[model samples]
Target: MTLRHSLLLATASLIVSATVAMAQEPEVDCDNAQTQMDMNICAGRDYKTADNELNAVYKKALEAAKETDEGFKDMGEQYVGAVDALKRAQRSWIGYRDGQCELAGFEARGGSMEPLLVSSCLADLTRKRTAELKAFYEQEN
Candidate 1:
């Protein structure tokens, strides 16, 4: 092969090796995150964990609501039953959470910290909601 062709091939191999190394980078240690990007990523991960927890609790709550609705099924179409009420409340809560987080992010609006602010707010609110849902059901047992 020509010298120029051989040099280009070697450079391509080096670039691919660097890409592979970056792709295999170690997971971030959230507790010791030092950079703004790492903190933002950690915050996002926290929110995801909280959200998953909330979803599990919400499913239980929804099932309870459905069971409650079975008892009130004869109340007629005019009356909103437990399932409907719970669904409405959950939808409203989601709207509130999103809006609140958007406002919280305004503290660092248009900056790199905005994502961290939003994600942190989301995680906090989601955890609180999960607790509330648990309390609501726990009261019955």
Candidate 2:
């Protein structure tokens, strides 16, 4: 009934609501995919998406840094390096994912559906990577 008590209750309610909203958000699980191929594919997708988001955020930050301080303009070079690294990692991951998935399909040292398995694996990897990047960017934003 008191003003102080009512304000305290309102603040607690807001905190609880915010916590629930965050907890209800979806999470990605590439490791637990139904098939090995699916897992790889999801991981690949997740990486690619993350790469894209990282690049976008870096670009925005570079621009903002430039505007805020002329001396900071050179920091864009750092962003460029980060972008390059992410891209390189993504490419290497693609190769590793496919190779691993194809190797998994070996029943008698080689299988007919190896290609399909590789594709699915790549997709699963990508999905998982994308989810990770989404989380990173979401935090930054």
Candidate 3:
């Protein structure tokens, strides 16, 4: 009933919870993820890798778009330049990706596998988008 006792109980509960959590957590092996948590973690890592590559390629695409727009600068306000068009398309693509991934997660619904599904979808979509951006940049170059 005392505040001191309450604080002590809370602290003990926290410590116990932390210990249990640590015990339950497995060492993730992405190559052969067996547990749900490990699979989720691996899927997240895949998404991160794809996102990083997408970001790098996107920067290159932006730069290429800028270069391409240089010739159009003289056309004044009448033209929608390459950089502007690319930015607009990229923004739309991001929205589409997030929505599509969220929809993919619905297969798992409220289950533990939802995150893994969403992450895998994101990774796949991001890699595909990165390829598209790379191809656009190459074509423009």
The root-mean-square deviation over C-alpha atoms between each candidate and the true structure, in angstroms, is: 5.2, 15.4, 4.3
* Candidate 3 deviant stretches above 4 angstroms: 1-27
Cα miss at 102, model 1 (Å)?
A: 0.3
How would you order the candidates by TM-score, starting with the best? 3, 1, 2
- The TM-score that candidate 2 achieves is 0.39
Candidate 1 has an lDDT of: 0.91
List TM-score per model, in order. 0.77, 0.39, 0.80
Q: Which candidate is the best by lDDT?
A: 3
1-141 per-residue lDDT for model 3 (tens digits): 999999999999999999999667456889988889889989988999999999999999999998888867788856647888999999999999999999999999999999999999999999999999999999987
lDDT, candidate 3, at 106: 98
Q: Which number leads on TM-score?
A: 3
Instruction: Give residue 12's error in model 2 in angstroms.
Output: 75
> Candidate 1 — which residues are off by over 4 angstroms?
1-26, 74-80
Q: In candidate 1, which residue pairs clash?
A: none
Off by over 4 Å in 2: 1-80, 108-116
- Lowest summed lDDT across 10 adjacent residues in model 2 is found at 64-73
| Cα lDDT, all candidates | 0.91, 0.58, 0.93
